[model samples]
Target: MGRIVLNGVRKAFGEVEVIPPLDLTIEDGEFVVFVGPSGCGKSTLLRLIAGLEDVTGGEISIDGRDATELPPAKRGLAMVFQSYALYPHMSVRKNIAFPMRMAGLPEGEQKRRIEAAAKALNLTDYLDRRPGQLSGGQRQRVAIGRAIVREPSAFLFDEPLSNLDAALRVGMRMEIGELHKSLATTMVYVTHDQVEAMTMADKIVVLRAGRIEQVGTPLELYRTPHNLFVAGFIGSPTMNLIGGAEAERHGARTIGVRPEHIASGSPDGAPWVGTVGLSEHLGSDTFLYVHGTGLAETVTVRADGEVPLRHGDRVGLTPNPDRIHRFDAEGSRL
Candidate 1:
């Protein structure tokens, strides 16, 4: 029952308004991700829901009750921050039990919740160790365990994996995804990393400068973006946007085609031809950066690893006509 709804929510500081009035509904048990570039106010929005920050206007509803004026402690939500924020002197067990102890739960109940959280986070053996003795990932798990014992209706994560190394981030990402499934609780996670949002979220809320650029499932946003901002931002390596003569031929102000959707071979009889400026062979896939196509940016093409193309070679590229995306002068999909 962790449904959260925001109606005309806005946030301001003095004369500047970071988040403008907006409406959003996060359904119960959905793993929703708020993702955007820096200073986009995704974290501020999350803080408003957690009651850590007050809204300048509008109402926030958690479940069925309005929580706009509630204090952070009474919001019934758990937040895991970018930093672990663990007490270096405290053991894992003590760290996890702090919340229950503050609420004056019985000794037995505190112990019960601590053990359950430890087991769930795979920290059963490390419970007696201090935060200083654990690895980065282990310490993060301890932080999550501390949050889990609160049994809040929803979990708020603010770039929880940003502190870890690449390998560790991947490991923790999968762990959090598993945690969501087992708990079946609504989770609102914030990250600037689109890869994280694409892989972990049931729904993604894309933001820019405090406003939502788009909201949909990973594939929905990938397959059919609402506008140029979304189309250019959503994909890896980005979709190639061509304008002027090429776009005019397609009866559009601009045309977009993904790298993988384009086929490359001999320059003869090809719709578009260019010289390969650079080529990257990454074992499983090969990427070619093509130049002299007359576009503002070099065209990037993803080809098979076995493709015998290299720098300085002439190549032809033909996009899958059915897969090409057309856009209007305003960057809206056509």
Candidate 2:
């Protein structure tokens, strides 16, 4: 329940700059996700906010207080790391209560907070279990619960779901979303998974090479990416990026279109054509990979249901002009 602000934040490891000067405002009780590819500085930014890494320049503030030089504990934030970071020797209850113990809370208040956190995370039955006895997902929950018991001003998650199985990841994602809703606390989650960002975040900060690429809601980034990098990175199956010359001939510098915007056959008001190179039936829809149009690689088109397309099928392809995105030679959106 605190507003977190970063003003001209920067990070560097000796001569190599990791994060360039960046400014972001995270409103109180908002869930903001920082997402990017590996080595793109998302985790670095999270660590900076958590005070795990000191900022090379600029300031970090939480709840109207400047905290640039504060230690991790003094920053009034709890971080749940990717590794869970649970103490293997401690029972679940003890582990979750450790932060309170460190802060010297009275026994009664500590017990009450621990019990409430365990119950909220559905860990009541596993309070006596050690980290060795819990499943990966359970251990992750304990890590989160430990953070919850601290009742910090904000929560920082660094790929907390990366170790879970696919199904567990989905379920835990929902749980985290619910946790945010119920707690109404400021949260900043960093992950390479775009799906996590798209599903959980009220706003997303997309980063690349230590610099921010775009900051917007999931749908806004999906619908209108500001550059080729974001246009290719934000979507499932990714958007198709045709060469500049080819796109310019079609009245655009570089054509970018989503799979769903492309069709298998000649749809009304559609333009561009390519031979269907490969088709994948995904039950609810079909993904057509079209090639041989002077494009760098195959273009994917999402069609409703199966469209009876196959590999090497000579088919005409068309994209909705209104749905097309144009980028300049430098990859900036035109």
Candidate 3:
């Protein structure tokens, strides 16, 4: 019953429109992620849904009820922010009980919910400790425990992991994914990190300059991007794009091939010839940056970690014709 729908939703500040009219739907128990570069309006969209910000036009509905004009507290949703906004003087138990206390729930109900949330987040032993006594990860769990106690219809996460270190971010990411499964609640998360989006989302909405560039599963966007912006942005190390004479040979204004799709040795007739400029061995895979290729200035290739290739070595590259992507002059897929 956590379904949320936005119909032609728009947001603006004075005269500058940050989010153009757009429509999106989040199904019950689905984990949806909004991702893009900074100032892409992902957070703004999340705020609009949370009722933290107002929309300039259109409607927002939660479970078939109009909530566009509802205040944040009345929207039946809980938000976890980038910062762990806990009261330093309060114990973890008190922090979690704050929400229930504000709503004037009975003491017995508050105690029950707090205990349940503490155990679920593995904070039972630490419940008596204050915020100053916990690590970064523990404090974050306390914040989430607070949200869990509220038991809102849906959860809104605004870059919740951004404040943690790399290792902690990874751990929290997995924890949040597990939380969603156990709770079976709809969750809307926002992040600029594509890796996080790829690992956590059931559906990903990619945006740029207030407009959605693509909306699909991680693999869908990776395998078949709608346009050049998507193709160049979705993958790690990025897909190699070549223009000029080489692209014309493929009957396209531009051509794209992912690093993993390019074989080190050319096939029957070599389409690309270069010298290895740099090689990176990451134990599991080797990435080679090839120079002097007639196509692009530099072509990146992913090869076996055991590949015996070194800098300045002459090399040949051949892309799998079936996997090659062609783009028109306007950067649209051909």
Candidate 4:
């Protein structure tokens, strides 16, 4: 019963409107991620839902009840921030018990929930230790354990993994996803990293400049973006966009081809010719930046990890015609 709906929700600061009116719905037990570049207003929207910030217009409903004006705690939601927010002086057990203690729950209830959350988060053996004694990942788990004990209807995460190193970020991402499965609670997450959004969300809301560009499953946005901004932002290595005469030839204002769709070896007659500018080998795959391509200033091609192509090597690239994405002059999908 954790469904949340926003009807014409908006946010403004003085005379400037940061979030224009928008509508969105998150179903019970669904994991949704709000993602976009910096200053895109994803965090602002999350705060609006959390009741930490009041909406300038319209309403927020939780489980069909209006909660727009409710204070953060009264809204029955929990939020995990980018910072761990754990009390350094408190032991893991006490840190997790803080929220229950504040609410004046009985000592027995607090102990029960804390133990359950600790075991669930793999912190059972570390309960006696303080936050300063744990690694970054363990400390984050303690923070999550604190949230889990509250048992809120929905959980809101504000870039929870941003503080971790790359390897730890990956681990925590999977851990959070697993937590969602085990808890089966509605979760709304915010991040600027598309990779995190793709890996963790059941539904993804892509925002830019306070507006939602698109909302759908990760594959939906990746396979069929609504417009140019979405097409360019949703993929890794990004989709290559070409304009000028080359695009005109395709009866479009611009043409887009993903790096993976551009093959290095040309067969018959390929449209792009360039010298490999830089090559990155990551064991699993190779990324080749091709320069001097008349179609675009630089055309990136994803090649096999064992690709023999090197810097300054002349190459021809062929884009899979069926996979090409066409956009109008205003960057709308054609």
Clashing pairs in 2: none
Weakest lDDT window of 10 consecutive positions for candidate 3: 265-274
What lDDT is reached at residue 212 by model 2?
A: 88
For residues 24-124, what per-residue lDDT tens digits would candidate 4 score against the true structure? Answer: 99999999999999999999999999988889999999999999999999888999999999899899999999999999999999999998898889999
Which residue pairs show collisions in model 4?
Answer: none
lDDT by residue for model 2 over 1-334, one digit each (tens)?
A: 5799999999999999999999999999989999999999999999999899999999999899999999999988999989988889999999999989989999999999989888888999999999999999899999999999999999999999999999999999999999999899999999899989999999999999989899999999998899999999998888988875678876667888898986666533435566777778889998888887667578888997758877876666667878989888788888
TM-scores for all candidates: the values are 0.98, 0.95, 0.96, 0.98
Using TM-score as the yardstick, the better of models 3 and 4 is: 4
**Residue pairs clashing, model 3:** none
lDDT of each: 0.93, 0.89, 0.93, 0.93
- Residues 1-334, candidate 1, lDDT per residue (tens digit)? 8999999999999899999999999999999999988999999999999998999999999999999999989889999999999999999899988888898989998888888888878999999999999999999999999899999989999999999999999999999999999999999999999999999999999998889989999999998988888888888888999999989999999989999999999999998899998899999999999998786368989999999998899999988999989999999999
Question: Could you tally the backbone clashes for each prediction?
Answer: 0, 0, 0, 0
Residue ranges of candidate 2 with Cα displaced over 4 Å: 266-271
Global CA lDDT of candidate 2, please?
Answer: 0.89
